[model samples]
Target: MTERQHTDQALIARIDPAALLERTRSWSAINSGTHNLHGLTHMAALLADAFAVLPGELSLVDGDAAESVGADGAITRLEHGRHLRLVVRPDAPVQMLFTGHMDTVYPVDHPFQTLAWRDANTLNGPGVADMKGGLSVLLEALRIIEAAGTPSLGYEVLINSDEETGSFSSARLIAEAACGKCAALTYEPALADGTLAGARGGTGNFSVVVRGRAAHAGRNPQDGRNAIVAASDVALRLFEARSPALAVNPARIDGGGPNNVVPDTAVLRVNFRPGDTGEIERARTLIGATTRAVAERHDVSVEVHGGFNRPPKPIDAGAARLFALVKDAGSAMSLDVAWRDTGGVCDGNNIAAAGVPVVDTMGVRGGAIHSTDEYLLVDSLAERAALSALTMSRIAEGALS
Candidate 1:
């Protein structure tokens, strides 16, 4: 194959499992929830500090938070920003990007938010399995490659602050970094059974606001149009759009009177996931039609805000090739690895949808993600990291044909 691939395969032979696990535990102790600005900042700084020790020049990519006003004054956006970059080789042709998120779903006050030892071989923590553990694995993987003292391809690592809530502003940055890159690896945790994700559905979050006149409930019932009822109808329409492969969940409904007058306004928070672009278009059309029909029939004005925040990413031809490369690397290490399609979407979907070939769920294998039982297998830290390091090195060496 190529010299880069050969170099990567040779390095995978000497990856140290113990060092990998130690680092995973180290990072898992820090809680970096996407909604917790302070925690996110601390996590970012920690990552930056750690990367500073690497051989390549490190650069920070700046991002700003969107703000809103609250009763207490102006409420700053929850997440501060993210860190991204390229760890370059003196000379290289292919560029590979490794990606992971520093943010988790758990909030600062969450009871499920700290690191604990499930056993000598397992780590229990909020962000441990979902991704902080994965980040650790990525770093260890890179360390293994760097220690080999052979460079195959220049690489970049993109860590973002806002991934649990759909990546918002960071989506564009991911897309931009992916341009001309050969492949991408996202360190989202693996399935409970160690299966990597081959394909994932795209996610879209939306809001529907129903506006109706408010009047005395008992004295002037006819004068008031119930926005709540209009919103309910809209919710029902949304659920009716669900199919076997597609899902629609109306997460929350807000607004209404205290049983005294008609509700002037009501809002519906809805989210959906579609496996393909066609499903996304169909869902958007259905939502629009249903919203308009409900508004007209109920005599209420409706405003629909938000659109497909994250496009659904399918395992296209490019991704399939990328997955094979990872699998090959794993096999060489005597690890039997396989991939399956998943319904849950992550930042990988955002990158893949932008036309970059991605091997997501390329993180430590673990179980119970997003729950109190969340834990990561200590052994997976080294195994997966070695797998990643090998893949990158092989790609550089032109080993995979």
Candidate 2:
């Protein structure tokens, strides 16, 4: 082993459990939903303070304007809060990009508002495992690295507020920051067993609004072309577009009226994950054709919003080497690091698209994410911090290129 490896081993042993848990507790308490601008702004300020431990200029940059369709089919632009950008030694010989999201699937009105202990070592709450715990791991790992000494490898940390909603506003920022970096790590939560995500499918979320003539059910119903029925038809077509490689999910449908009225407006929200770039393009074309065909067939007007944003993160040679580095780091601590392809897309996908190799699920081990049952294994906080510290230190030492 090299002298740098010795230093890495020493630093990994310095992982702090108490501080990690405290940070997680602090972050998970806030409900930073994608649409909660106030909550996200507050969370960004808190994160800016916590990340101040590292040598970096932490600043909040305004996110891109996001669009939402109203019930009347009017598109409105909304802000995605602010994105936190941290730069440390950007001119250093080695460059890396680390990313995560501060937002959660839960909203302010969600009943799962606070963290509760499932057991002495298990903490449950929204965003606990999904990413708040991951951010804690990231912070501690960087602190460990900086404490060891100033690193030769400079890194950029982007904590965007809109990733839960497909990174509508921060995709450009993520890609631009990753341009010159050799490697990237996304702090999305890992499985309970500490496995990472290897290849990830590119995902696109779409909202299709259908409009038709509305009429009272008890009156001349024939004068109305039911939009709900048209929207349902579009939903079925999208679902049928799925294949063994392309996974399509008709997540939800909104804008239905009372039973006594022939509903003339309906919105269908759907998401699809494609295994590769070609598949993503195919999905787009198919969806467009299907939407037009369905609209014409049902005599309705259709409007579509959103498209594929993150390109697929394939486990090519570059990505495989990156995973090997992480797995080796894990093995040093008697931890067997493993990974598999996930259909779930993340900001890591965007980074990988920039030709940077990335291991996305480097966060704390947790499960039952995006739900009330979300929980984090408290021990993994210290364990994964050590693992990340080792990986980062090695990367800084020119072990990975």
Please provide TM-scores, in order, for all candidate models, with all chains considered together.
0.91, 0.94
Question: RMSD of each candidate?
Answer: 3.1, 1.9
lDDT of 1 by residue, 204-245 (tens): 887787888999988998998889899999999889879976
Q: After superposition, how far is residue 317 of candidate 1 from its true place, in Å?
A: 2.2
lDDT of 1: 0.78
Off by over 4 Å in 1: 1-10, 64-79, 87-91, 399-401
Question: At residue 352, what lDDT does model 2 achieve?
Answer: 83
Global lDDT of each candidate = 0.78, 0.88
Please give, for residues 256-307, the per-residue lDDT of candidate 2 as tens digits: 6788899888888888888889888899898889989988998999989988
Clashes by residue pair, model 2: none
Strongest candidate by TM-score: 2
